[model samples]
Target: MDKDASGPKVVVGVDGSESSYAALRWAVRYAGLVGGTVDAVSVWELPGRYGWSAPAVDMDVDEEEARRRMRQELTDVLGTDAAESVRTHVVHGNPADVLLRAAEGAEVLVVGSRGRGGFARVLLGSVGQHVAQHAGCPVVIVRSGPS
Candidate 1:
């Protein structure tokens, strides 16, 4: 749906990875062309299994810090003018789930082929694949290669 009089809103997932950075850049350019705002989302999740140690307190604080850094990084890459057109969001949960939820009201969802995952795939990352398959809106899987 359109968030403004200009055009439909676009959502892009960011995890501070090189591929995600590329996707952010592409999303900014696309938004500029289509006259829409970009919602940059950064999702953080606690490690499922930690060593035989006590659960850490104040974890939410860490997540918030990470989110703030991510938003600043996106702003830095997109620059002040283009970044002003972007709305940053930081959520704590599964990356794929957060992105899919964000995609619910977006005209298009953009994500990189890979993030910090250590999967051995030669192509798309697991999170990107999941979003592409389940996102309600059109999904753009930005790769690290030439456009």
Candidate 2:
């Protein structure tokens, strides 16, 4: 949360996907329009449905690696100059849960229609669906592909 300021706080989720980059860009513009600050959150979690009696341990998804990817995603999309306005957050948890937590006191929560996985769709990614249904504030689910 951007609790130190008086303006609106806009929270967005980025997952190092093209759709996520779109969400980040859209959030920046939306924040500019509403005099809000953007909190770009990227979440990592233990792999679900692991076979062979695997535990909730994922060696491939490191927290530091996720943070670096998120940072680089912002830099790639927003560039160094414009990306400064966005405050990045990297968390370890369910993406939906993390975004919902971030949206606790936010004015708006923006996310892409789909993340790195999932079939093609519009209006609701799994994470976006969860957040939109349970968030405390307004939710904006931005579609990435052509309209």
lDDT of each: 0.80, 0.82
- Please, what's the RMSD in Å of model 1? 3.8
Query: lDDT tens digits, residues 1-147, model 2?
Result: 457756999999988777787888899999999998999998776665324365655566567777777777788899987787888888877788889988888989999888877676544668878888899999988877663
| Residue 19, model 2, lDDT | 75
Candidate 2 ranges with C-alpha deviation above 4 Å:
48-54, 58-62, 121-123
For candidate 2, the lDDT comes to 0.82
State the lDDT at 17 in candidate 2.
71
Q: State the lDDT at 126 in candidate 1.
A: 85
Off by over 4 Å in 1: 1-6, 49-60
- Per-model clash counts, in order, read 0, 0
Give the candidate number with the greatest TM-score.
2
The global Cα lDDT (0 to 1) of model 1 is 0.80
Kindly list the per-residue Cα lDDT of model 1 for residues 56-132, writing each as its tens digit: 44544576677668767977888777777778888877888889888777879999989877774557888999998
